[model samples]
Target: MEILAFIYFDPMYFVYVGPALLIAALAQWKVKSAYAHGNKYNASSGLTGAQTAQRILDAYGIGNVSIEAAKTFLGDHYDPKHKVLRLSPEVYQGRTLSSVGIAAHEVGHAIQDFKVYAPLAIRNGLVPMASIGTQFSFALIFAGIILSSWMDMPGARYIAVVGLGLFGATVVFQLINLPVEFNASSRAREILQQQGIVTAAEDKIVGKVLNAAAMTYVAATLTAILTMLYYASIVFGRRD
Candidate 1:
């Protein structure tokens, strides 16, 4: 009980806990604000998400990729495995600025795939491990600490270290994701402008929507990195 209490009150733990929650809340706010603004401006192009995706793909000369409509909202994504682009129902059918901006974002992934973007490739490779890391890292760390208390050995420290390493993978992946997402948004904006798909007035709204959406990913990455640092400090700092 004493050890656990000590760990709980450890200054490093508070450091990690505070930033993680703050970043998460910021991400949520940015996502909601972007979505709302995009919906409000709506596009004059009359191009559904599906159409926008197709146009972008075609412009990039990516004839091999396929675009499909998804059933969820803001669920648009590109699957490199199948070379398919999936857009959520709202995006697939809606002709709003938000929908078009988002649609272009997915298409940007297709462009990345065609060009073999290094960051996207790295992110793809890390997805499976990161997914597992998310599930087990925290659990293992907590269990290791408890076991260490029960057995009176340093096994808890070892376990916590391993957990921290796994969680670190998640942070690395999130960092890589930041560039990929931001680049995709940049491509989307450029394509929208180049193709005259949106007028000058509408372009402003598109930029706002894309920028807001990008903030969510930035927030997520910041939170992940901060979390890794927090755990590392707790497990290792106390040893000295």
Candidate 2:
């Protein structure tokens, strides 16, 4: 019963998850700073983000993909099923280092699709479970806690275990996503250099932008992992 109170106010939970929260905050700041700085410097190629994406697609002989302008800020993504690269207004029209760099990163995912990258496929497959976990995992966990702690129901702890397992899928998805994102950024940097889309010096700025963006994903992964561990410790610590 005392352990159940940790759900609302647990110093140990902070001990498990505090560093991840700090990292997430720092990663977010780094992303904003790098993006803002990169946006100020135009790529020497004089191409808009859309054109840059087209250039990369054409270079790779990947003609099936279509590029579209997205309305949301920082909403850039590659939809492999539809073969569409959606870039935010800033990345689709800005012509700055951040714009083309982000566009190229999305294009990198398109290239992964064209090449049938295994990790991307795995991540895609995990999407359903991850979605379910994101929506219901915590609800189930809290419900189990309520039942076992307040009602003393038999087998209620197993409900929490199930919830934890579901949340584990989300964790696994984030873990697999790290390589996919890093690989896409790697591809973007290489192609940007090979095609001379950015000068050697400008590529450094692009690298910072992409690396900062990757850090956000790293932070998210850490958060998910630590969160799972925190709940696991609580769930398993209780004596039924």
Candidate 3:
């Protein structure tokens, strides 16, 4: 028999999930819109994202990190494991504020790694568990629900509890990640100003782009939290 979670529920699941979904959609829209708006003009410094990131790293006395152009669109990221900063083509070579800001934000991660930022360290530490939890939590929950009432298997409750615990670790990971992202953006804005890479007006626009990017993280974390709560309510609501 296919498991329908909890057999039944009393808590209003949609009430929580609907808003989170809406926010996530809005965040995604903002990211695209903000990027498009910021991409229209070249920065006064005429430096591309890759160049700007290299300068910022040099400014911070971070000499070991390498920058590379990633062919993927909007695929910018900092790989701490390899000490490489990967910028999408648009960011790597584009002279627009959006490109610079986005690239700088990833470099901010590299900065955090160099400084041994506590929250980032914690977030990194949780990566393995969070990755496992994200991939397997739902499957385990469904399995547990399916076997809950099966007289032959008495371990259903334990399975469900383990699933919930794993998912809870994911939630913890998201919470820790928030500060890491915010701090990175803050550092990016400061560096842009201190280095005169962007004018005052341009810095404001950079903030807009970076803030929009941050909202996507917020939306994701919010959705994860609410979904976890909804599942938890159902899983624990029933007593065997």
How accurate locally is residue 61 in candidate 3, as Cα lDDT from 0 to 100? Answer: 96
Clashes of each: 3, 0, 0
What digit string (tens of lDDT, one per residue) describes model 2 on residues 1-240? 675556668888789999999999999999999999998999999999999999999999999999999999999999988999999998899899999999999999999999999999999999999999988999888888778778888589789889999999999999999999999999999999899999989999999999999999999999999999988887777543
* Segments in model 3 whose C-alpha atoms lie over 4 Å from true places: 1-12, 150-155
The worst-scoring run of ten residues by lDDT in candidate 1 lies at: 231-240
TM-score of each: 0.90, 0.96, 0.93
Better of 1 and 2 by TM-score: 2
Error of 3 at 197 (Å): 0.3
lDDT of 1 by residue, 1-240 (tens): 655565557565556667767767876787788788888765777788789888878888899998888887777899999998988888888888988988998888899989999999999999998998999998877776667665777757799889988998899899999999999999888898888777878888888878877877877887788877866665676533
Identify the leading candidate in terms of TM-score.
2
Q: Which stretches of candidate 2 lie over 4 Å from their true place?
A: 1-4
* Candidate models: Cα lDDT each: 0.83, 0.92, 0.88
Better of 1 and 3 by TM-score: 3
